[model samples]
Target: MFTLFKRSIVLILLGLLWENASRFSSINPAFCPPFTEVLQAWWELAVSGDLWVEFSASIRRSLAGFSLALLIGIPLGLLIGWYPLVRDLLNPTFEVFRNTARLALLPVFILFLGIGEISKITIVFYACIIPILLNTIAAVKSVDLLLIKSARSMNVSSFKLFLKVIFPASIPSIFTGIRMAGTGCILVLIAAEMVGAREGLGFLITYSQFNFQIAEMYAGILTISALGLIVNQGLILLEQRFSRWKQLPK
Candidate 1:
C-alpha cells in the first residue's frame, strides 16, 4: 500500500486540486463540477442500472468490430507479409485506404448500412483493422532470419517451418497491435454511438451535456476512460499469458 501510494501521489494531489478548485475557486461549477460530484453521479448511474445498459451496448459493438478485425487482420497480414507478389500488389491499396481518415467515411457507412448497429460496428472495424493488419505484417516480416535458416537446414517443410517458428515468434507483435486496437475501438465506438444511438455511453454523455446534467456528463466521460483502462489492462494480461506460453517448449 505504501508503494502504491508513492506511485499514485501525483494523481492524489491532482484530485485534491480538482476538488479544492471546484469548492473554492471562481470557476463555474456548471461547466466543471467537483470530482466528487462526478463520482456520485457514477454511483447513481451504476445503482440505477443505467451504466450497465449503456456500457453493454457500447462494449458489444466494440467487441463485434474488434473481433472481426482480429479474425481478418492476422491471416491477411501474414499472407501479405510472407508473399512478395501479394505484398507488392496490395501495398499501394492499403497505403491509400489507411491514410484516408476513417471518420471521413462515416457518412458512406451510414448511407450504406443506415443509422444502426451495422454502421457503427463497421466503423469500429474499419478504425481498428488497419493498425492490427499493419502490425501483424511487420511481426511476420520481422521473424528472425537465423531461425528460418536453421529450420531450412534441417529440411523443415515450409508449412512446418511457419507453425514451428514464424507464427510463434510473431505472437507478441500481434498482441501489441491487439492492445493498440483495443483502446482505439472504444473511442471510435463512442463517436459512432454519439452520431446515432438511443442508448450508449456516448449517448449518455451527449444527452447529459445537452440537458445540462454536468455531473452526469462528467460521470459518463470518466466511465469511458475507465472502460479504456480496463480493456487495455485485459489485453496486457492476455499478452503476458501468450508471451509466457510462447516461451514454453513445444
Candidate 2:
C-alpha cells in the first residue's frame, strides 16, 4: 500500500509539471496540450462508449494471440528441449527467426495476409511465440541434475519422471516466458493496429493525429499506457501464484 502511495505521488508530481509546461511555460499548447485537456478528451470518449469499444478490441486481439502462442510454444519447446534430434533440427531455424525483428516481417505478413484482422492477429502471434519458446526450452534444459538423479534412483519411468520432476522445476522459467510474451503481444498488437486497424487504441491515436486532435491523441496514448500497466500487474499476480514454490529458501 505504501509503495502504491509513493507511485501515485510521483505520477501526481509529473502531471503537475506537465500541466505547468503546457499552460504557463513557453511550450506550445498545440504540441503539448494541458493534462486536463487530455483528461477531458478521455472523459468524452468514455461517456460516448468509444473508449470501451477500442479498449475491448485491442484486449481481445492481444489475448487471442497470446493464448495461441502459449498453447503452441510450450509443447514445441518441450519437445525441442527433451530430444537431441529435435533440437539439432530446429534450433538453428529458431535462432534465425527469433533474432529477426518481428516488425520487419510486418510488411511481409501484410502482403501475404492482407490488411485484415488475420494479419494483425498473426503478427501479434509471431511477436509472442519466440520468447515463450526460448524460455520454455531453457527451463526444460536447465532442470537440476539432482532432481533427475533422485527420480531415476526411485526407478521412475521416463514419462513419470518428466511429470513429477522436470515439469515442476521448469515452471518458473516458463512463467518468465509467459510474462515476456504478454508484453510482446500488446506491443505487436498496437503496431499491427497502426498499420491496418479500424478499431483499437492505436487506430484512435492515429486517427486523432490525422485530424489535428492533439488532446484525443494524448488520451489514446494514456489509455495504452494504462492498459499496459494493468496487463503487467495481472501477469505479476499470476507469476506470484504459480511460482510460489520458488519462494522457498534454497
Candidate 3:
C-alpha cells in the first residue's frame, strides 16, 4: 500500500510538471495539451461510454490476432526445434518471412483484405507471430540435452519425456515470447486501426486530430498507453505465477 501511494504521488508530480510545461511553453497547444485538459477530456469521454466502446473494439482485435498467432506459431516452432530435418526445411523460409516487416505489408493487406477488421486483424496477427515462433523454437532447442538423455536412460517414453522435462524447461522462454507477442499485438492493432477504423482508440485519436480536439487526442493517446501498461503488467503476473520456481533476487 505504501509503495502504491509513493508511485501515485510520483506520477501526480510528473503530471503537474508536464501540465505546467505545456501551459507555459510557446509550443502549440494543438500538438500538446495541458495534462489537466487531457484528463478532463478523458473524464468526459469515459462518462459518455465513448472511450469504453473504442477500448473494447481495440482489445477484441488485438486479442483475437494474438490468440491465432500463438496457436499457429507455437506448435510449428516446437516441431522445427525438435526435429533437425524440419528445421532445415523451414528455417530459411521462416527467417525470411520474419524479416519482412509487417507494416510493409499494410498496403497489400489493405488491398487484399480491405480497410476493415480483416485487414487490421491480419496485420496484428502477422506482427505477433514472429516473437512467438522464434521464442518457442529457441526454448525447445535450449532444453538441456543431459536432462533428455537421463530421461531416456530411465526408459521414460518419448511423449512423457517431452511433457515432463522439455516443456517445463521451456516455460520461461514461452512466457517471454507471450509477453513480446502481446506488445506486438497492441502496436499493430493501433497502427492498423488508425488507417481506417470506425471505432477504436486509434480512430478517436485520428478523429480528434482532424477536428482540432487537441486535448481529446492527448487523452486518447494516454488511454492507449494505460491499456498497454495494463496488458504488460498482466503478462508479468502470469509469468510470475507460471515460473514461480525461478524466483527473482530481492
Candidate 4:
C-alpha cells in the first residue's frame, strides 16, 4: 500500500494541478472541466448504473479475448519452442499475422463478421495472442540449461521434467508476456468497441464526445485507465503467488 501511494503521488499532484487550472484558466470550461467536476460526472454515471453497465460490457469482451489468447498462446508457444518442426512451420505464419496492424484488419472482420460482439472479441484475441505467444516461446527457450541437465541426471520423464523444471523456471517470463498481452487486450478491445458497439466504456467515450459531454468523456477515459491498472496489478499479484519459491533462502 505504501508503494502504491508512493507511485501515485505524482499523479495526485497532477490531478490537483488540473483541478485548479480549470478553475482559473481562460480556456472554456466545456472543453476542460475541473477534475472534481469530472469526478462528479463519473459518480453520477456510477449512481445511474451507466458506468457499471458499460464497464461490465467492456470487461466481458476483454476477458473472453484474453482468456482465449492465454489458452492457445502458452501451449502453442511451448510446442514451437520445444520442437523445431512446429517452430519452422508456424513462425512464418505468426510473423505474417503479427506484422499486420490489427486495426487495419478490423475492416475485414467487420465485412465478414459484421459489427457485432464476435468481431470485437476476435480483434482483441488477435491483438493479444502475438505478445503472449512470442514471450512464451522466448521464456521456454531461455530456461536454465543447468536446471535441465540436473533434471536429466535424475532420469526424469520429459513431461515430469517440463512440469517440475522448465515450467516453473519460465513462470517469470511467462508472466511478463501475460502482463504485456493483458494490457494490449484492453487497448485493442477499446478500439474494437469504439469502431462498432452499442455499449462499452469505449462506446461511452465516443458517445459522450459526440454529444459534447466533456466531463462524461473524461470520466470514461479515467474508468478505462483504472480498469487497465487493475488488470495489470492483478496479473502482477498472480505472478508473485507463483514465484514465492524465489523468496526461499539461498
Candidate 5:
C-alpha cells in the first residue's frame, strides 16, 4: 500500500510538471499540448469508437505473430536442446538469423510479400522468435543433472523422462521467454504499422503528428504506453500462476 501511494504521488507530480510546462514554459503549445488536451482528444476518439477499431487491428496482428512464435519456437528449442546432433545441425543457422536485425529485413519482406498484412506479420514473427527460442534452449540446458539421473533411475522412458522432468523444469524459463517475446511482438508490429499501415495506433500517431494535431499525437502515445503496461502486468500475473511451484525472488 505504501509503495502504491508513493507511485501515485510521483505520477501526480509528473502530471503537474507536464501541465505547467505546456502552460507556462518556453515550449510551444503546438509541440507540447497540455495533458488535459491530450485526454480530451483521447475521449473524443474513444466516444467515436475509432480508438477501439485501430487498437484491435494492432492487437490482432501482434497476437497472430506471437502465437506463431510460441508454436514453432518451443518445440524447436526443445529438440535442439535435447539432441546433440540436432543442436549441431541447426544452431549455426539459428545463430545467423538471430544475430540479424529483423527490422533490416522489412524492405525484403515488402519486396516479396508486399506492404500488406503478411509483411507486417512476418516482421513481428521474426522479431518475437529469437528471444523465445534462445530462452527455451537455455532453460532446457540448465536442468539439473541430478534430476535427470534420478528420473533415469526410476526406469522412465526417454519420452516420459522429458515430459515428466525436463518440460516441467523449464516452464519458468519458457515463461520468461514468452514475456520477452510478447513485448517484442508489440514493438515490432507498431514499427511495421508506422511504416506501411493505414490503420493502428502507430498510424494514428504518425498521422496526427504530420497534421500538427499535437494533442491527438500525445494521446496516441499515451494509449500505446498504457496498453503495453497493462499487457505486461497481465503477463506477470500469468507467469506467477503458471510457475507457482518455483521459488520466486522476494
Candidate 6:
C-alpha cells in the first residue's frame, strides 16, 4: 500500500508540473486546460449525476457487445483449433475479416443498423471478435499434444479430456483474450458514441468540445482513463483468481 501511495504521489506531482508548464506557455487553455480546473469541472459533473448516467450507458453498451463477441468467438475458435480441416477452411476468411478495419465499417453499420444503440453495439462486437477468436484459437492449439495423446491412450472420454486437460491449459490465454477484448470494446464504443449518441462519456466529450467547455472535455477524458484502469484491474483480479494454478514463484 505504501508503494502504491508513493507511486501515486509521484504521478500527481508530475501531472502538476506538466499542467503548470502548459498553462504558463502560449498554449490556449481551450486546447488544454489546467489540471486543477479540469478536476474542479469533474467534481461538479460528478455531483450533478450527469456523469453517472453517461458512465452507466457507456458501460452497458460495452459489456453487451463484449458478451456477444465472446459467446460466438470462443466456440468457433475452439472448433477450428481442434480440427485441422476446419482451421484450413476458415483461416483465409478469418484472416481477411480480421485485417479489415472495424471503423471502416461504421458507415455501413450506420446504414444497416442505423444511428442507434444497435450500431454502437455492433461496432463494439466487431472490434472485439478478432482478438477473442485469435486468442481462443491459439489457446486451444497450445494444449500439449503429448498430454492429449496420453489421455486418449488411457481411454479418457473426449469430453473428459477437454475438461481435464484442454480447458485448464487454455485458461490463461482466454483471460488474455478477454482483456484485449475489453480494451477493444471501450475504444469501439467511444468511436460509435461519438458518431451518434446522446448520453455517454463519448458524447459528453464531443459535446463539451463543441460548446468550448475545455475543462469539461478534459474531465470527461480523465473519467475515461479512470474507467479503463478500473476495467483492466478488475480483469487482472479475475485472472488471478481463476488462474491461480498457473502462478509461478516470484
lDDT of 4 by residue, 1-250 (tens): 9998999999999999999889998867889999999999999999999999999999998999899999999999888987799999999999999899978998999999999889988898998888998888999999989999999999999999988988888889989999999999999888888888999999999999999999999999999999999999999999999999888787
TM-score of 3: 0.94
Q: Each model's TM-score?
A: 0.95, 0.95, 0.94, 0.96, 0.94, 0.94
Is candidate 1 or 3 superior in lDDT? 1
What lDDT tens digits, residue by residue, belong to model 3 across residues 1-250?
Answer: 9988887898889898889888898877768888988999999999999999999999999988988998898888888888899999999999898899888998899999999888888898899889989999999989989999999999999889978888788889988998999988888788888888899988999999899998888889999889888988999999889888777778
lDDT (0 to 1) per candidate: 0.91, 0.90, 0.89, 0.92, 0.89, 0.90
lDDT of 1 at 14: 87
Return the lDDT, model 1, position 93.
Answer: 97
Q: Candidate 3 lDDT (Cα, whole model)?
A: 0.89
Worst 10 residues of 4 by lDDT: 20-29
Per residue, candidate 5 scores C-alpha lDDT tens digits across 189-235 of 88888888899888988888889988988888888888888878888
What tens-digit string does per-residue lDDT give for candidate 2 at 1-250?
9988887998999999999999999999998899999999999999999999999999988888888898999999988988899999999999999899999999999999998888888888889899999999999999999999999999999999888888888988998988888888888888888888899988998899999999999999999998888888898898889778879787
Better of 2 and 6 by TM-score: 2
Tell me the deviation in Å of residue 24 in model 1: 1.1
Clashing pairs in 6: none
Model 2 scores a C-alpha lDDT of 0.90
RMSD of 3: 2.0
Clash count, predicted structure 5: 0
Clashing pairs in 1: none
Task: Give the range of the ten consecutive residues with the poorest summed lDDT in model 3.
Answer: 25-34
Candidate 1 vs candidate 4: the TM-score winner is 4
- The positional error of residue 147 in candidate 5, measured at the CA in angstroms, is 1.0
Q: Highest TM-score among the candidates is held by which one?
A: 4
